[model samples]
Structures are given as C-alpha cells and as structure tokens.
Target: MKRIYNTLFIVGFISLFMSSCNDWLDVRPSDEIKEEYLFETGNGYRTALNGIYRKLATFDLYGSNLSWGLIDGWGLVYNLDKAPDDGGGRAMKKIATFSFKHSELTPTTDAMWDAAWNIIANCNNLAQQVENEDTLLFYDRTHERDMIFAEAIALRAYMHFDLLRIYAPSLLMNPGERTFIPYVDKYPSYLSDRQTVSYCLQHIIDDLKKAQSILLSVDKSASFSMESRFIQSYNGESRFLGYRGYRMNYYAVTAELARVYLYAQKADEAYAEAKKVIDVVESKKWFAASTSSSGFNKGNMKMMEDIIFSLYSTDLTDWDQKINHLSDNPADEYNEHYLCLGDELVNEFFGSEKSSDWRLIYQLEGKYYDYYYRTLKYNKQKEGTTYSKVNDEMIPMIRMSEVYYIAAEAIYKTDPALAQKYLSSVKKGRGIKNVDYSQVTSEEEFINMIVSDARREFVGEGQTFFMYKRLKKNLLGMEGYSWKEVEAKEENMVLPLPDSESNI
Candidate 1:
C-alpha cells in the first residue's frame, strides 16, 4: 500500500508538469531538469497549481468516490441492494450498512486516506517552494504570485477539512475529542501525532483567513473586493491570471469559511460569512439559479447557472460510464450495474404538488429494477452519441444555494422569518411557490425542511452524507437501517483510521 501510495504521488506530480502546455505553465523540461527547476518561474507555479486540480479530477478523489459513487452511496440516497455483488458494490454495501470493519472495505478506505494525504503533500511542496525568495524573484506580476499562494493555502485547508469529515468523529458528536487523523500542514513524517478535531478545524479556519487576506490584497478596485477583480480579470487573453468560478477564488474561500463555521456550530459567525457571500454573489450577478428543464440533462457539462466553484475535467466520461446502467435494450438491464435512487428520496423530493421542480425532471424510470429511479445527473451522453463528447465537464463543488441553506440554518433560532426567507429563495429558484413561514410550527420542522431541500438540491453531488453526519440526524430512507441504528454499534461517528496509520 505504501508503495502504491508513493507511485501514485510521483505519477500525479509528474503529470502536473507534462499534461498541459496552454494556460498551465508550458515549459518543456530538459533531460536533466531537477524538481527545483519546476518552481523557479511563475509558469512553473501555475503548472504545479493546475496539477493539483488535475489530480483532484482522477478516479480516487472528487471525480468519483468523493462525489457520487462512494460517499453519496454511503448517504443511503441510493438503493445499494440493487448494486451488483462486485468489489465496488461490496464496498458500497459496507459503507451503506455501516459495516465499517469489513475486510473488503480496506482498499477503499486506504485509497481515500492516501489520495487525500497525497494531495496535501503536493500542497505542502508547492507552499514550501513558493515561499522561497528565489521563487518570488520570478514573479512578473506580484498579484499572480499572491493569487497562486492564496489558492494553495485554501486548497490545503479544503483537503484537510474533507479528511476530517471522512476519518474523524463529527464535531456535534465528539466536540473537542482527539482523533487519530493528524492535521498535516508540512509533509508527513512517520512520527506525526494525532490532533484534536477542534485543533484541526481551527487550523483550517486560519488557513482560509490567510487565503482571504491574500486575495483581498490582490484586488486593486475601489471596493477592494477580490470578487470584482476576479470578474474583471477574465479578459480572453489574460485567462491565465483571471480567477474563474472553477478555481478557489475569494468567494469560494468565504463560502468554505461559512461551512467550517457551521460545522463548528458558530451560528452567528456562520450566518455572517454565508450572508456576505450571498450579498456579493447576487450583487455581482456571478451566478443564477437554473430554471431550465434541461439544466441537468445529458450532454450538458455545466449543471446549473449558480455554481460557485466546480472542477473542469475531461475525465467526466469516466464517471459517466461508471453510472450509466440504463440501456435502450431491456435485455441489458439484468447484466448492467447502476446506483438506484431510494424510494424515500423519490417520494420526498418528487412526490409533491410542486412537481414542477427542475431537479425532479432528471429522474428516469428504471426498466431493470422495479419501482426504482435511476438519476441522469451523472449521465453525460450526447443526443446521438453513446457518451458525452464534451471535454470540459464542470462538476460543481460549491454553489450559491448552499450559502442560503447555511444562513437559514444558522439564524433559524433568532430570526425565524429571516431564515424562512432564505429558505424560500431556494424554493423560489427551483420554481416552487414562496414558503409561508407561518406554516412552519417549530424550529425542528424548519430545520427538517432545509435538510430535505438540500437532499433534493444536491442528490448526486455527495453532500447529503455530510449533512446527516453534521446534524447527527437519522437517515430518512431504509426501514430499520437508519443512522440511529449505526450510531448504536459504532464507537465513533466516522470510519476508523486505516491500518497504515493505526499500526504507526
């Protein structure tokens, strides 16, 4: 496993420099060029940064397991029993059933741990080089240099937070409890000690603050807003320096800070951060809610209009092929493998008088599995082609809708009317009529409404599990197999650290 880890790291890092010649740092390397040469120029830093994103688009990380395949399946949003009894299906069953100790899960768990840390390792390497005086000398534009560093810091924090989300107990459950997962900033040595969850979260928050500060400094506009500069910087010729929604820009960092605060249960702070993002994004017209019926349809790479941050990957077809189990021929249904949506999800989201919700339109009737619904969310096939021809597939990582949810939840205790307004914005965007706050009887009911909306809004995006874990709520689907049942048998809310770390 260690050997595999090292091999993956080396390949990923090398590919960072070799993969792209345009937009990315485009220097050709000499036969004897050392690793140090790669960071001696601004282009080198840019290439290195792009490399991190490329690695993120691979099968192990956001491209698959972290998004629709493993994590969302674990959320019990899908009918895991319908999955074939292959290695992938067995792993999904272990995750869904909360059978954390099954030996079959070792490979999946180990891959997640290694891939996250591997990205962190690359982050540390980039930070170390970028901070050097010699590297600073190569910066033709200091703003570009600062922007690169800011993104690196933010990306590092994001990866650490995700690692904690996967490997440590939820803050709501364990508060300041120590976890086996170490908050690694520097490249890891075997001697690293585990940090408390509180310590890790604080570290993540601090890094995001640094990123926010750096981004603000780069903005020379009268408003001194990084978001404004990010918009202005996107002239066609200067695309390299322009901050796209796909990149970790100022608003993305702010959105992430709100998420971290919500996880920490800092309601006031979370509300403030979320509201700040909402105001800036709306005022600037950075994104709009998707009201089109074909918003999530196949062949469309951009899923919505209100995406705050996403990953542009040519490898989206790989993800598409993995989940495209539906066929034109009914005969293929028995042999094909797919993740089926749970009846609970279908009924809760689509079984309402407000059936006009655009999200509901993506559900296709399953010919193979009776009474099952298969999602076209991952289906990227074109009109005539068997698969998507689109290379630049945008996989949404964050969006404006999440901010509204966070704001609504954070302020629900003090300002029910305001919270309901925030929640109503999401519903209004989805074509549902304005929600009457008077109809909501209690705080718990309002919270459930927000959770339910989130379940529908982010069905295949791999956010539902994190929502369940954070709120410590029971899974609404699967009779007798809710999170409450799993919580009873589990010592902690998270999967155990892999043997590699446990042995250490």
Candidate 2:
C-alpha cells in the first residue's frame, strides 16, 4: 500500500523554555486547530514556520543523513566495512558503496521525499494565507507576518534546491534537459509535472528574490530600522537573538543565490553574487576564522560567528552516538564500524600541507581508536550532559568560508588575480600561507588547488560529492583502487525517484 502523505494542519506552539530544553527549533503543536485558525494570527504563521525548521532537523535531513551520514558515505570518503551476518550492516554498506538499488534505500529516499514535500506544502499554505490576510489585522509588533512569510518562501526554495542536487542531473551534462523532480510550489495534487533543472532553478531564484525584497523592505522600515530585527529571537532576553545565524537571513539568501548560480553554470552571475557577500562580510565584520587549535573541537559552540546558516539540534549527541557506537560490546572503543578518512585522500591530497593546516591537524585525527581516523566536527557532546542537557551544536548549512570559495571559482577565468585574492582570504583565515596567483602556471592547476582546499575545509559536511559531481571531476578512490570520473549518462549521480512518485 502507498502511504498517503498528509500535511500537519494543526501546529501547537511550544514555550521558549520547553523548546530550548528539547529539539533546537522544534515547535510541538499541542493543539488541534483548523488550518484556517492556524494561519489567522501572526503567531500561527510563526509557529508554522518553526514547524518547517523542526522538520528539517529530522534524522532524514540535515540532522544526520544529509550532513555526515549517507551523503558523505556516497562520496567514498570513509572506510566502510560490510555488516556481519546479523544483517544490521547491509544499509550502511549500501550507502558507503553508492549502491542505491538495495531495498534499504527505498525507505531512506521515501522519507526524504515525503519530509521535503510536506515542508513545501506547509510553506505554500502559509504563503497563500499571508496573501489572503491583511498585515494590519494581525499583531504587527515584530513585523511578524511579513518576516514569517519571507522565511517560508526562502525555505521553500532551499528545500527544492537540495532536492534538485540529490535527484536531478548536473546542468553541465544535460543542459536544457527536463523531466526529473517536480518544482512543487502549491500543495501537491498528486499530478504535478516533473520539472527540468533549468525550470526548477529559475523558480528557486524567483522565490529567493522575493524573500530578499521583503527582507530589504523590513530593514528600511522606520520602527525597526536595524537589519538585526529580521533575525531577532522570540525571547527578547536570549543571547542568541541578535545572532540569527541559525535562521535563513539576508546573507544566507545571498549565499544561496551564489551557490545556485554556480550549480547552473552561470559563472559571471555567481561571481557577482559571491562578491556582494564578501563585501558585506568585510564591511560588517560579521565573521572571523577560528584561531584556536581546537577551534572546531567537539562540545564547542564558539564557532557560531563563522557560520552563516546553521540548523540547531539538541539531539546531536544522540545522533553521534548512534553512528559511532555500532558494536555490541560497549567497552570496545576501537571498533571498525566507524567511518574513517580515505587513505588516498590523506596521503595524496594533504600530503605535505597536512602538518601546517590547523583544519587538518586539529579537525582530522585517528586518536579516537587504533587504525580508525574519524572526524570530530560533529562530535560536540559535553562530558556531563549526555542525554540530559541540550547541546548547542549546530549543523552548518552555509558559512563565510564557502562564500570565499565560490567567489574564487566563479572569477578565476576572467580575473585570476582577483580570484587568487579571494582564495587566499580563506587560506589566511585558516592560518596557512597565502597563494601567489602568478605562481600558478595553469588554470587546471588553479582549479585543482581550489577543489583540494574545499576537500580539506568541508570534510564531514557532505559537500565533497556535490563538488565532484558539479565539476564532473574524477571520484578519487582509496589507495588500492583507481580513480574514475563519473560519466554524463551515469544514473548513479542522481538518485531515482521514489516508488510513490513513480507509481503516481
């Protein structure tokens, strides 16, 4: 039987105290109200927006699967061993090998599809309600209505873009090609046509543009003239109020614009958008690199300033434990079930630079267990707070370092000097020596340097595969295996649609 996907019509709002104690941004809807009542008030719209964020923090999305789990496994970065006869390791092996044909993947893909679409459905419902109602009627204290509406639009675009990355072909290989994932705006009627990559990207850009316009207007308003007003927390006294890096704010929208342009192969456009963000970061001094050797150490939330958009999750420890603790014996600390850094990547890519790079020296290590080098980026659990306290570790969705990388890649063709400057910005931030563009003899060498830096910078963040796919670069294998580039016609680059969509 095909499981019917339904929207959560009634969303209950949780108190700030309770919300902080549990999931980072989950809005537990305690009341069963009609959809009409839910959208009638400004608080209703806000609650609905919070619910969307909560859905994104699920195990199927950024909380686990998308970040350090399935996606990174697919990138072939880890050493994945086959499961024992107990049958628990089959799914892990399939994900590590990129074998999506396993029956286990069906549930994973299906959950992703359903969760993403359900969030989109809610965003559509909120958007329609905002259009139908008057801003003056609802409590306009915080410019709540417009802000919530804008967030909904931006998040809708964000989810759609991720879906495209996972399921559609790279635009480089199949420009103007159509018919993959649907660009769903309205609630699905079970008959939405599959959209082309070009069409979906255009729609996503349109939504982000709308959100940017709304936020700009809010920034210019007389009562709340400060730009921080858009990202202020519900609790006035909270330390995290002004630090709205957790929410999709203006800068995040701009960053996403740059990313989308890069994915669409619009180099010039991407360069411009990325430069705009770089200029803003410079003018506002909104970010700084981690100076401490243990800057990205586990249990640390000090790097929040460097992050542009991060999803809050109190259940990070739980998720980390589940992935790291695969053995039946609790005392076995050296179990091989954990994912290790690729041997070739460590030997070839970071050969000489590994010692100087703090990102490598501190972030990547094999000290957790013998012959098991694991990434501690996501291991942020405090010593005494396991299963009892809320850890503030966030899943970084976008960061300032990424913006610099984007700018470097986009402008390297037209302005090599300027591109090198942008690239060196990240290098300097990471305490590494600056790169001399004049020293780089060929464009291919420059590009390879950029990709290598990205590999080092974004380890365990699930960006390596997308970087490889977007550039059609060869997927690097472990020491014994030969590297092979993914062909344009390869079906594995993008996952197949779920059985529900196929059945429909």
Summarize candidate 1's per-residue lDDT along 435-481 as a digit string, tens digits: 65666788889988898888877766778888888888866555322
Tens-digit lDDT track of model 2 for 420-484 = 88888787777677454665877788988888888777776778778877887756645223443
Candidate 2 positional error at 54, Å:
0.8
Model 2: lowest-lDDT 10 consecutive positions: 15-24
RMSD of 2: 5.4
lDDT of each: 0.67, 0.65
Could you tell me how far off, in angstroms, the CA of residue 99 lies in candidate 1 after the best superposition?
2.3
Clashing pairs in 1: none
**Model 1 RMSD, rounded to 1 decimal:** 5.1
Clashes in predicted model 2: 2
Look at candidate 2 and give me any clashing residue pairs: 12-29, 299-380
Off by over 4 Å in 1: 1-33, 85-87, 132-140, 188-190, 219-237, 294-302, 326-328, 331-336, 363-370, 381-392, 436-438, 479-492
Return the top candidate by lDDT.
Answer: 1
Worst 10 residues of 1 by lDDT: 3-12
